[model samples]
Target chain A: MSDRATLSTVAARAGVSPSTASLAFAGSPRVAPATVERVLRAAGELGYAGPDPIAASLRRGRSGVVGAVIGERLLYAFRDPVAVQMLDGLTEVLGELGVGLLLLAGDGGPAPAQLGRLPLDAAVFATCGLEDDPAFRLLRARRVPLVAVEGPVVAGVPLVDIEDRQGTVELAAHLRELGHRRVAMVTMPLRLDGRRGPVDADRLATGVYRDTRERLLGAREVFADLPAVETASNGIEEGEQAGAALLSGPDRPTAILAQSDLLAAGVLRAAAARGLAVPGDLSVAGFDGADLPWLAPVRLTTVVQPTAEKGRAAGRAVVALLAGEVPPDVVFPVVLRPGTTTGPAPA
Target chain B: MSDRATLSTVAARAGVSPSTASLAFAGSPRVAPATVERVLRAAGELGYAGPDPIAASLRRGRSGVVGAVIGERLLYAFRDPVAVQMLDGLTEVLGELGVGLLLLAGDGGPAPAQLGRLPLDAAVFATCGLEDDPAFRLLRARRVPLVAVEGPVVAGVPLVDIEDRQGTVELAAHLRELGHRRVAMVTMPLRLDGRRGPVDADRLATGVYRDTRERLLGAREVFADLPAVETASNGIEEGEQAGAALLSGPDRPTAILAQSDLLAAGVLRAAAARGLAVPGDLSVAGFDGADLPWLAPVRLTTVVQPTAEKGRAAGRAVVALLAGEVPPDVVFPVVLRPGTTTGPAPA
Candidate 1:
C-alpha cells in the first residue's frame, strides 16, 4: 500500500505539477492536450489509476454518493415494487446529478456504523420508520443533509410524503359506497418488533411506524373499531397469514382493506384457499398502484400514488440540499383506481 | 465551508492534543473517561460532528463501501425477484463484513464517471452483459477487485457462476422426453441494445450476454435449429409481448421454453388470451423458479438457481480479495423443478 503510485509520482514523470497532472486526468480544459497526453503516458507507465477518489473527495468535501436507508432487509425492500419504482426514479435524477446511490440497511441493521463511517453528501430515508431511528440520529450528528420519502417529519429534513392517510380513506370510502359494512383491515407492521397478529389498543397507541398508523387511522375514520390484523412485514406471505387469521374468525368480514398491494394479493390468495369468490363473498382493496401483470384481468381496487414522481421529488430535494438550499416538504396526491376485485356487497 | 469546526478546534477548546481528541471520539479505552467527557463537551459547544469520515477514510485507505454494478435500469433490475434475492444475499454477507453496497448503473448509464469519482474498495458485476462492458474496463483500469455473478470469465476476477448451460440442458431434455419436437424459445436480451423480437443468425452469433447465450445454446443442443425470440428486458410485460409474437405466428410450436419465470408468466397470459389450455394444447417451461404468488395453482416448470447463495459467494469473494487472497471461482449447481405448466406435448 505504501508503494502505490500517487499523482505526484505521475506528475514528476510527466514534468508537470501535481495540480496540472490532476487537471490532465480530470480532462479539464485548462490543461493543454499535449500535457494531458504526457500525463497519461506517465500514468500508464507507473500503473497509476489517476487521482485517488478518497483523497479527491476529502479535498472536494463531497462523496458523489447519496445513501438510501432501507428500513427493512434488502430482500424485503426490493420485493416491494413501490420501493423499487421510487428508487428507480431517484436514480434517474441522481444520475443526472452525477452521484451514485448507496443502499444502507436501516432497521438497526449495519446502518449506524456504516452511517458514521461511509461518506455521503446526503441521505434519503427510503423506508425506515420515523420514530427513534438510530440512523437519523447518526446522520444528524454528522450534519449530513437528510431527506425522507414517506417517513417521519423532522424540522430540518425535507419529507417527500404521499397521501398515505387520505389514500386509505378514499379506498375505505369506496368499499363503504359498495354497501360493505363488515370490513376488516390487513395492516403493515405497527411496530418494528416483527410482531404479527391482531393489533391491540396498546400496540396501536405505541405504534412507531408513521405510514402504518396513518393508514390504519384513515380506515378507522370510515369504519371505527375496525378489527385489524398486523403483518410482520409488507409482503404477500405476511398478508396471506394475516388474511387467513382475519377470515378464520366466526364472523368473517365482507371486505378486507390491505395496507399494500402485495398484502392485498396475499389476502386474495387466502380468499381463494377458503373457496370464496373475490367480490361475491369478499371485497378487497389495496394501496399503491403497483403493476401486477400476473393479476391481469382482475384489476385491484387500489389507491394509485405517484411512486416514481415521489422518488424524483426526493432526488430533486437531495440536489437542492447539496446546493446549500433548503427544500420544502412535498406531498403528492393519490387516486382511487376501481378494478374487478372490488364490487357491490353480496346480496 | 471554511468556518466549519475541525477536530483541532475542538481539541484546543478541550485543552487536549488532536490525537487524544481523536481517540476520545473513537471511544478508545486508552483515553481517560474525564478527558473523553471534556472532548465531547467541547465538540458539542463548537458544533463539531466528531471526526470527518472523508479524512478518516483517506487515512485508512478504505472507503467501507462496495459497488454493485447493475447492468439494467434500477427499476427493471429491482422488478426481477431473482435479482432482488441475489442482492439480498449479497447484502447479508456484506452487512456482516461491515461494508455498504453502492449501486452503480452499468451499460453506459452514468457509471464510467461514477466509477472514476466514487470511492469503492471492490465491485461486483451483478447483471451486466459480459462483452465490451465499459464499466468492466473502467474498474479494471482502476484495479478494483472484481467479482461477477454469471458473466463472462475474466482472468484474476473470481466468478460466482451457476449451472446455467447444464440447468437448461436438463430442462430442454425434460421437454424432449415429453415428445415435444416443435419447441420455440423466449430468451432474455441476447445483447444490451434493447432489441426485441426474433433472433436472427447474425444476432445469435454476435450475442454478448453469457447467460442468455448459454441458456439458448442448452435448449438448441436438445432441439437443433430452435427458433428464439429475444426480449428487451427480463419482465412480465416483455415476456407477454414476446409470447404474443410467438403465439401469433402461423407455425405455432407445441411447446415454448421461456428464459425466465416472469416471461413464462406472460406466455401463460398469451395462451389464456388465445383460449389454449396449458399442458393440453401447449406446454410451457421457464428458467428461474421464482416465487410467483399471483400465478396460483399453476406452478412453472423451470430451473431453480440458488440466487441468494450465488450472491453470498460473490460477497465472500470480495472479502477474500480485500484480504489479499485470490478466491477460486465458484460454480453452483441448479435443479430442475417440475411444475404444473409442463407435461407431455399435445397429443
Candidate 2:
C-alpha cells in the first residue's frame, strides 16, 4: 500500500509537535505565525491536505450535514414552487447554522440503502407523506434528529405543519358564497403510488398522504358528495387532465378546486382549450399561493400557505435537536387569497 | 462516559462473533437466518442501530456523498426550470448509484466552512462561474474528484459542457435572417456579484461566469455591438427589470434575446406591459429548452440545449472519477426551435 503523508509526518518535517501542527492547520491563534507558516510549508511539500474530513467529523461526532428526505423524485419536488420555496427557506437557515443540506430521495425513489449508510446529524422529512415512511423508521433507528413538514403528527418528531384542512375549508366556503353549488375537485396524489383518476372510496380508505386526505376532507365538509379526480402528481398538466375529465361530463361543475397552484393553472388551460372562460363559464381555486409570473392577466384564487417559513421552521427544529433540545412543533396558518380566477358562477 | 451499545455488546448477548453480528445486521446471506434473528433480538433489547455510518465510511474510505456547488441561492436556482430539470436528471442517476447529493452553496452564499468539514467523495460544480472559485481550490486541494457543468475548463477536471456559444449564434443568426438589424440581449449574471442593469465595458471585461460570457461572445459574433442588459439573477422578475431597461430606451431593438427561458418569459411580460405585440412589434428568443407549461400559447423561439442530459453526463463523470477512471469530457449539441415569439422585423 502507498504510504500517504499524515499530520505527524508534516509535524516532524516542520520540527513542531503534532498538536502544534494540528493547531496551525486549524488556524488557531495559539500557534505562532512563523510556526504555522513552517507547518503549512511542510504540508505542501508532503502533499498532505490538512486532515481527512471524515476522520475529523468522527472526532467531532457531527457530520455537519442535514439530510432532507424529499417524498417525491427531485424533479417533481423541485418543479413544485411550494416545495422549492420551502427548501429555499430551509437552506437559508441551514446556511446560517453552518451546515450543508443533503438531498435524499424518499419512498418514491431509491432511498432505503442510501439512508442506512449516509452520515447525517439530522433528517427532515420535507414534502413527504408522514405515515408509514421507511426512511423515517431508518433515521429514527439511527437516533438521528428528525423533523417533518406538513405531515401527520409523529411522536418525538417535530413538525412544521400548515393549516391544510382549514385553508381548503375557507376556499370551499368562498366558492359557496359565490353561489357555486355544483363543484368538482382536482387533488394531488392521494397516495405515493402515483395513481391518477376518480377518487373512489377504496382509494380514500387506502390514502396515506396527509395533505391530500386533509384537503379532500375539508372540501367535503362544505360540499358533501363533491365529485373529485385524483392527479398522478401536483403539476399543471395533471391538473389539466383532471379538469378535462370533469368538464367533458354532461353534468359539468361550475367550480374546480385544485390542491396546488400548478394544478389550478393546468385546469385553467384545460378550461381555455374547451372554450370556457374562467369566472364566466367555470370558477377555479388552488392551494399554495405560488407566484406564477407567466399566469398573468388572470390571477388564481388560492389558499396561501407560508411555504418558506415552514422550511425555516424545519431548519430551526433540526438545529434545536442537534443542540439536544426538543423543539416545539410549528403549525403555520394559511389565508384565502381571492383573485381573478374565482367569482360568481354563471346563472 | 456512558457505556453505549456496540457491535461487541450485541455479539456477546447473541453468542456470536463480532463479525457475525455485523454480518447479521447487514443481512448478509453468509450469516444464517437463525443467527440473524438472535442478533436482532439482542440489538432490540440493547438499542443498537446497526453500526455508526461515519465509522463505517471511514473504514470504507468513501462517504457516498456527492457535493453539488450551485452558483446561486437555492431558491433562485430551483425557480429556473432548466436548473431543476438538470438536478432531476442528476439525482436520478445518483439514486441508482446509491449516493446522496449534498447541496453546497457556491460563492453566492455561506459555503466555505461547511465545504471544508463535509465528507464528500466527489464534487460537481453544477451551475457556477468557474473562475477564482474558493470552493474549487478547496476541493482540489483535498484531492476530491471534481466535475463541472458548463464552465471554463480546468486541468484534469472533466466538464459536461453544452454548446452554449454555438446555440446563441444559431438564435442570433435566426434573428438576423428575420431582418432584425437592431437586437438587444438580456443575460444571466456576468459575475456572481448580483449586479444588474446595462452591460458596461467594465462588466464585460470582468465577467467570470463561463455560460454568460460564452453566450455573449456568440451573440457578438452575429450582431457586433448588440446592446445588452445583465440581470441580478436568472429569474423572471430580474428578466422583467432588465427587459424594461432595454425597452424603455429610445433605441428599442426589434428583437430581444434572453440567455435563459425564464428571463425570456420576463421579457415577454415586459413587452406585453408596454402593449407591444409579439412577432408583429417585437421578437423575443430565449436559451435553454426549459419546459414552461405556464407560458403556453406563446412558444419561445430559442436554443434548446439538452439540459437533463448535461446533468446525467456530470453524474456519469462523478461515478467514473470515483471508480478511479478518468472520464471523457462531454459536450452536448443544441438546436434552434423557432416558435411564435420570433418573426420578421416590422417595417
Candidate 3:
C-alpha cells in the first residue's frame, strides 16, 4: 500500500503549475500532449488518481451521468447477451470521456420504477419497443438531450440504430433463396407496452415496437405474405410459445424466422418437441449475432447485428449531444450469416 | 413535447419552500412521507424529472465511480453472459443509490493499462488466478475499497464469492451417485493469466484461477483422482481445446466436468465431431446455470451461481464503502442443476 498522493505532488513532479496539470487531465486541449504525458507520469508515480469527478461535474454544470435503458428488468436484461454486448460498447465509449453508466432497468414496462425520478445528464433508451420505458418519458419531460438505440425516433431526438429492416430483409431473402415458401416469423413486441398475445392486422397497421416493426417490415419485404406470431418478450419461453402455436397449426410453414437468437433457440426447441427434423424437416433462423455454444453442432442462419458498435454509437451520440452537436442518425449494417439451420426447402 | 419543470415550480404549486419540496422529492428523512408524495404528485403534474444527479453527486463529494474491472475489453465483457448477468445485478442496485458504474478493462498482466490509468474512487475485481492482476495492483496502490467476485479474499477487500468448491463437490457426488468412476474435468485457466495446459497434481498445486482451484479441490474430494485439462479462456474455443485434449488422450474418462457452460458446450461439439454419444459414451457436467436455448434438447448438468445477486452484492458493497462503512463479505450459493448433458456414467 502507498500513501495517498495529491494533484499538487503530481504538478510538482511534472515541473508544471498545479493549474497546468489540472488542465491537462481535465481534457483541456490547450495543454500540450507532452505536458499532459509528463503530468500523467508524475501522477502515476505518486499514485494520484486525478481530480475528483464529483467536484469537476459541479463546475461543469453537468451530471456526467450516462443512463442506459434496458428494455426490461435486471433479470431479463442480464439474460440477453445482445443487450449486454450493446451496453459493453456504450460503457467502453463512455469510459474514454469520463462518463458513468446508469443502468436503468426497464423491464416489460416503459422504465424502472425510479428511473424517471433519478438525476441524469443524458440517456440512451428504447421508447417504441418498451412498455413504459421511463428513460424517454423522463428525459423527454426533463428536456434532456437523449440518444435512443433500437427504439422509437421521437421528433428531434437523435438515434444510434441498425438497419433492422435490411438485416431481416436479407435474412428473409436468404431463406427464400433456400427454396422456402411458407415461413413463420417470431417477432419482438409490436408496441411500447408489454401486451403480448397475437399480432393481428391492427398491430401491424399501427406498429409501435421500433425493433420489431423494422425487422417485421424487412421480413415482409421478402416474404410478403408470411404469417408472424408474436412473442410476449425476447425470452426463449415466449419464443417457444410462438413456435408451438405456429408449428402445431395445420399447414405448418417450412421455415421459421425468429427476431432474436433466443427466440430462434426456442423455435428449435418447439420443433424438436414436435418431432420435426431440423433443416431436414424444418428450418429456423434468428437475428442478433450471439454465441449459443449450447446449440453446438447446430449453427443458426441469422442476421448478425454489431451490438457493441451500436452501443458505441449511442455513447458517441451522447458525447456529441453533450458537446452541443446533433449526431446524425447512425444505422449500422447487419451481415446475413449463413449457418446450418437454413437448408433447401424440404422435398 | 413537455416543458422541463423545476422543483421550484413543484414547491410553488405545493405551497411549500423550495428546500421542503427538494427534500420531499429527494426522499430525505427530513421530509414527511405524505409531504414527499404531495411533492411527487406536484412534480409529476409539472413533468419535473426529480433532482439533478450531477448536483446531488457534487453535494455528496463523490462521483459514485465504482470501478468495475472486467477480465478484458468492453466487447469481451459483454460477450460473457455470466459476467453480464452479474453486471446487470450490480447496476440495478447502484441505480437505486444513483451510483454510476465505471468499467475498467483488464488484460490480467503485471500492470493493467486501463485500471492503473482510470480515475476511480473504488474498485471491484476478481482474483484472476494469475500472479496478481494489474487492475488489483493499481487499485491497491490507490487504496480504493475493493470487492472481489470469484476470487480469493485479499486483506482489506471484501470478497463477493460463491461456493464453487461446495457446488463442485456436490456435482462430483451426484456423478458418483449416478455410477461414475472414471471422470475428467475441463476447466477455465488454471493460472490467473494464460494457457496453463493441464491441471495435474503439480500444476494444480500452483493454480491461479481461484474458482478453478476451489472447484477442483471440491471435485477431488469425491473423485480424488479426476484428470483435469485446463482451457485457455472461458470461451468455446478454449473449451474445445481442452475437450480435444481430453478425448484424444488414451485413458478416456466416462464422464467429464467442465468449469463453465460455454466450455461444456464446446466439449459437446468436440464429442459430436468425434461421433461420440452424449450421456452414453461420455456424460458431461459444467458450472454456471447459463441459458442455452440453442442447445435445444440438451441441457447441461452444472453448478449455477447467482450472477445478478453477486453483482448486486458488489454494487451494495461499493455503496457501503462509499458511505464509509466496511461491508462484510457476501458468499452466494451455487446449485447443482442436472440437465440432459449429464446422466448415468456408463453401462
Candidate 4:
C-alpha cells in the first residue's frame, strides 16, 4: 500500500501466484471465473487495474506497434491525397492485425534520436528518398524488419513501389494521342531540398527522388524537349505556381501534364485565371487518379496508381517478415484514365 | 554467440558492468567515449545491437508514445479534412515534445481489446461521444493522462472544445441580416445511429451529438420554423445528397446553411447541377472554414474554427498532465469568414 501497486502486489494480496494473476489479467480461458473475480477484487483494492503494457511487451518480445516514417512536415505530407489514401489502407490493415500505427517524423529521412527510444515490432519507410538514411541503418542494426514503400529497393528490405516510369509513359501517350504537341510538365520535387523553379537537365541528373526522375524520363521519351517546372512540394498551390510560370509566356504550351492530381488541379485553376478554356485553349492531365471530390465536374486525365493497395501490400509484407517469411518486393502497375481535362490540342 | 546474445553477454565480453553497457546503448553522456566504443565492439561481436526498447520502457516507467483515439473507420475519418488538420497540429506538438503518436481506432467508442494492448503514457479522446466508453474506462483504470476534445466532458479529463453554439448563432445571424426570411439547414449526424433524411423537431430533441444539436438550435433561434436535413455522415457527397433532397421541392429555402464545409460544398454542387448560380439563385454557407483549395474562386461563406489550434491546445494539455499539472479546459472561439458564397438573399 505504501509503494506504487503492481500485478505482483495484487497477486500477493489475492493469495495467488504471480502467473495466475497475469493469466487473470490477460483473460485466459483456463482461469476459473471465481479466481478471475478474486483477482479483480484484489486488483481494485490495491489500485492495480492490470499488468503494465511495457512489462508485458518485454515478456512477449513484441511491441504491438508498427512505426510508419512519414517524410516531411505532416502539414505538407498530409495535404497530398495520395499519402492520406495510402495511410488509410495501411492503418486499415494494421488495425485488423491488432497493431497500432505509430507515426514517426521521417522529414525525408529518419531522426535517430527519436527513432531510438520508441519500441517497434516493424519500421516502414513510407516516404521516398530513404535509400541511405542513417536512422534506417540504425533500425537495421537493431534487427527491426524494414518495409520500404516508395524508395530505393534495398536488399533484404521488403519494397513496395509503383511503375513510375510506365505510368508517366502512359500519361504522355494519352497527351500525344490527343494531339498535344507543345506539352509542358509540372513535376514533383527532384531533390530533398526542393524548390519551385524551372528544372534544367543538370538538376534532373542530380535528382535523388527516383519517382521524379523516372517520370521525367518517361515523359522525355514521348516529347524529346519536354519543358518542366518543378515545385517545392506536391501541392495544388505549387502546381498553380508552376502553371502560372509556364502559361504566362506568349507561346504557352498547348497541354500541361502534372505529376499529381493536386498539381493538375492547380493547372486547371491557372487556365481558368488566364481565361483559357480547358482542352480548347490548353489540355491538362495529372498522375495519381485520386478522387478529389472538390474538383468535381472536372475529371482529370490521369494515370491511376493503386495507392491504397500499395499501402496494404507494404503492411502485408511487414506481417510476413514478422511471421519469419521473406515476402518478395512488389511493383504495382499504373494505367491511364482519360477524363474531360485532356482533349485534342487547339487549332 | 552460440546462444542469442544479450546486453549482459556484451557487457561481460566488454569488461564492463551491465548498467554501463546499457548506458552506452542509451547514448548516455556520463559514459566515457572509449568505454562506449568498447561496448559497441563487444556488441558487434556478440550480435547485440542495443537494449530492447520494451525493457528500457519498463525500467523507465514511460512508453514515449501518446495514443490518439480516432473514432469511426479510418477510411471515412481520414477523408474528413478537418480531422486531418487537427491531427496535423496534434502531431506537430507531440513530435516537438519527443513523443511519438500512436493512432488507435476508437470506432465511435474504443476497442477494449486493442486499447488494452497499447502502452500509452496518455490517451486523447479526439473523437466525439466518448462519455461512457469502456476503452476510456480502461485507460482511466491504467492511470493514463486523459484529454478530451468535443465530447461529454468528464470530471477530470482535460477538455478542448470550440464555440459551437456561438459560432452557429453568428452564422444564423449573418443569414438573417442578408434579408433571408426562409432559411434551411443541413446538419451533421445528430445521433450515432445517423441517417439521411429530413429531421423534424422530435428527432432534434433526441439528438446525441452536442455540436449538431447546438448548431441546429442556433439556427432555429433565427428562423423559428427552420427545416433541417440530417445526413448520414459529414461528407461533401452527403451534403450534395442532402442538397438534392432539400432543393427538389416546391418550398425551397433561399439560403442553406450546412454544418461543415464539405456538406456546404455539396450544396454548391447541387446548385450547379440544377443550373442555379451560387449567391444569385441560392446563398450557401458552411461551417469549419476549411482550406478547400479545390473550392477556389468560389470562396464559401463559413464559420472558421481554429481546428489546428484546438489540437495544439489538447496536446499542450496532454503535456501538462504528463508533467503532473492540471491544465484548464480550453474553449476556442470561431469567427465568421465572408466569402463570395454569401450575399443578400435572392431577390
TM-score of 2: 0.95
For model 2, give the RMSD to the true fold.
2.4
RMSD (Å) of each candidate, 1 decimal: 2.2, 2.4, 5.4, 2.5
Q: What is the CAPRI rating of model 3's predicted complex?
A: acceptable
The per-residue C-alpha lDDT of model 4 at residue A342 equals 87
Q: Residue by residue across B1-347, what tens digits does model 2's lDDT show?
A: 45878889999999999999989978899988999999999999888988888888887899888898887788878888888788777887787888889998653244685577889999888988567788888888888899989875898999899888899999999999999999999999988787888888888989888999899989999999998899988989888889988889999989999999999999999999999999899999999989998888889998999988888889889989999999999999999999999999999
In model 1, how large is the Cα lDDT of residue B71? 88
Ranked by lDDT from best down, the candidates are 1, 2, 4, 3
Q: Could you give candidate 1's per-residue lDDT for residues B163-190 as a string of tens digits?
A: 8899999999999999999899999998
lDDT of 4 by residue, A1-347 (tens): 28878888999898999899999988899999999999999998988867888888999988888898876666677788788778777876777778888887654112567677789999888766545767787888888899998775689998899998988888898888878889989999987686778889898888777788888889988998899999998889889999999999767899999988999999999999999999889899999888888787778989999989988898898889889999998999998899998889887
Give the winner by TM-score. 1
Q: What C-alpha lDDT values do all the predictions have?
A: 0.89, 0.88, 0.76, 0.85
For model 1, what is the alpha-carbon lDDT of residue A81?
91
Between candidates 1 and 4, the DockQ winner:
1
lDDT of 3 by residue, A120-178 (tens): 67888832354334456667777778787866666677877788888898899998898
- Candidate 3 per-residue lDDT over residues B118-148, each given as its tens digit: 3346777832434366667666765677888
lDDT of 4 by residue, B1-347 (tens): 29768889999999999999989987899999999999999998887767778888898888888988876666666677788788777887887777888887654222566677788999787756445666778888888899988876789988999998889889989989999888899999887575779898788877767788888888888788799999988888999999988899788888999999989999999988998888988999999998888788789999999998988888899899989999998999999998898889877
In candidate 1, list every pair of residues with a backbone clash.
Answer: none
Candidate 3 TM-score versus the reference: 0.81
- Badly placed stretches (over 4 Å) of model 1 are A107-111, B1-3, B25-49, B107-111
